[model samples]
Target chain A: MRLSNLADYAVVTMSAAARHCGGGRTSAAELAAETGLPVPTVQKVVSKLSAAGLLRSVRGAGGGLQLARPAAAITLADIVEAVEGPIALTACIDGDECAVDHTCSVKPHWPAVNAALRGALAGIPLTQLSKAAPREPNPSGISA
Target chain B: MRLSNLADYAVVTMSAAARHCGGGRTSAAELAAETGLPVPTVQKVVSKLSAAGLLRSVRGAGGGLQLARPAAAITLADIVEAVEGPIALTACIDGDECAVDHTCSVKPHWPAVNAALRGALAGIPLTQLSKAAPREPNPSGISA
Candidate 1:
């Protein structure tokens, strides 16, 4: 199953934020430029992320968005759930009404499967997702 | 992001087939009726599933389609991938041309995230998704 474009954008945006950690707060416009996403889309994602508490926002000058916690403490699951809802693969898992729920034997097993998926995403810390700082150019012409 | 509607239908159809294990072959119409999915939709899903080798089709009188292997041998990952191709959450992980790929620091980390997601889906055996047989009626008035 493909992740929705919105969720994909959220991950990209969060990755950019992770890179800027400790450097200072970043605004939606800045993140959009950093991630190459459109400014409006980045704003929507930023709003959702902030509402989900994955990001903390401030309105005054010299203030913007920053990760709510250390990058190491945040996981892909958090990012996904911030943009989407809980990591349910099926609506039935979220107690949504489904016509087949009564007759569908597979209903009971979805929770376990969903848990497995969430756990998988949770295994990846955001720290691992941030790019390493760019290395300096080699001082000597010869390979070090 | 949500699993596409087709992918969800695919899982439902396969779950129905799993319930009929050893019962004989089934046709797309039969699966549609069984799962309450529309006939054309079932046909499309069945075709994809067959091409993926999750279902084997036999054309002739007294012939239909059946699971390629025991339900226990098949995983949710197989069914999802059968309908939707590889289970990557992001396009970059598939090596597709992404405009932001060059500057995206998170690109390298997606493979691990994707692998985790696939592994999670792989852990759920189709057998677990099949409905258990209804318990026999109790002869006495007491609930058994």
Candidate 2:
């Protein structure tokens, strides 16, 4: 299965946001430029992320968006879900009654599979994803 | 991101195949009927799955498809990858040169995220997916 383009863009947008951590709040226009994503798409992502509580927004002069929590506290699952609802691989798992067949036997097991997939995404933190070079030693020896 | 429809259909088709495990080979037409997926779609899925060695095809009269190995040995990763190449969450991780911007600093960390997502899919065996109710004891207690 593949991620939708919107979801992919969300991750990219979030990565750009994480990179700006501690640098200062970033506006949607700035994020769009950083990610090279369309301005409208970036705004949509920012709105969704903000509503999901992953991002905090301040309006008015010099106001911008920032991560609501530390990057390390946010997971890919959160970013993905913010854009695409729960990280369900199948509609059946999301509680949409299967329209294919009433007696479909495979329906029952989808939840566990969905859980396993979500768990995997949850294991990854934005800190790990934002790090440019996790393996290389810090040039400044600041121990990031 | 969402799994492409093809990938989701592939899982449904394979699960249908797994249900017929000991009952003998099943043709693509039968699978189409069983899954209520279009015949052409089922055929396409069958061809890819066969090429990936997840399904073995027998030609000529009485010819059909069978799992290449026991259902327990097959994993969700195998089914998904068969229909949708690698289970990479991001195109950047797929080795495509990022077209967005050269200065995109978050590119490098995607591989780890991709790996985590794939690893999650890999952890789920087809047997788990094909089973209708994993927690319930079989009335026959035949040990599926």
Candidate 3:
């Protein structure tokens, strides 16, 4: 499974939002500048996030966008599902139809896998993630 | 993140392989017939699984494929990576460089997310999955 580039940008932009929560609106253009992401890309991410109810957008001067709810309430899974969609390890894991949808012997175990995946994602909330992180570009850079 | 359809096929086909394991080398044709998957698609899944060391293959009249190791030892993640390359939430999750790779603050978190995701996947071994499942297809049509 691969996360689309859009999901990555969404997380980055959301973190940017969290950093500005209650401070005032942050424009997608400014977020793009701060993160070095393309303005159009960040714009799309902001729009999608706003559509997902993760962000509340406002228009007019000094108006932009910010988190709709507390950062603590937003989980990575929520953002992912909003930017992406329901996480499915395999379509048959939760889909209504597949070759073995009815007569498959190993179908039940998939939901467990899916649930575990969701739980892992849900464990990470935007509140925790929005914290100012060290400038390290990769966690592995810390050197075990 | 979206799962490649190939990975889904691999899981579904492997389940079929594990099911017909005791019956001797199961051919891709047989898997396709049993699972109602396209023959070519099933063939690709089997070949990929074999290449990934998940399945052992033989040639000749009775030649076919069987699990390389007990299903218990294999996790869904292993199967997924075998078919899809890797489970990465972002381009740089593997420590690769992106255009804006140099200035991101949350690069540290990406790896944590990756690790968390991998850990969740690794926790689910096929052994547990196979055992939790009955040897036969369930009576009620679970999927739509």
lDDT of each: 0.79, 0.77, 0.76
Instruction: Rank candidates, TM-score, best first.
Output: 3, 1, 2
> TM-score for every candidate vs. truth?
0.84, 0.82, 0.86
RMSD of 3: 4.6
Tens digits of per-residue lDDT for model 3, B1-144: 657777877777887777677787889898888777889998888888889889999988888889998877888778888988767777775667777843665665666666667777777676655564443255343221
Error of 3 at B137 (Å): 18
lDDT (tens digit, per residue) of candidate 3 on A1-144 = 667889888888888888888787889998998888999999999989999899999999888888899989998899988988777666665554674443665566666556667777887888777666743465553221
- Number of clashes recorded per candidate: 0, 4, 2
Off by over 4 Å in 2: A19-24, A135-144, B136-144
Better of 2 and 3 by lDDT: 2
Report candidate 1's fraction of native contacts: 0.55
The residue ranges of model 3 lying beyond 4 angstroms of the native Cα positions read: A93-96, A99-102, A132-144, B131-144
> Best candidate per TM-score, number?
3
Q: Find the candidate with the highest DockQ and give its number.
A: 3
Q: TM-score for model 1?
A: 0.84
Give the TM-score, chain B only, in order for the candidates. 0.86, 0.87, 0.83
Q: What is the DockQ of candidate 3?
A: 0.41
Q: Alpha-carbon error at B144 in model 3, in Å?
A: 16
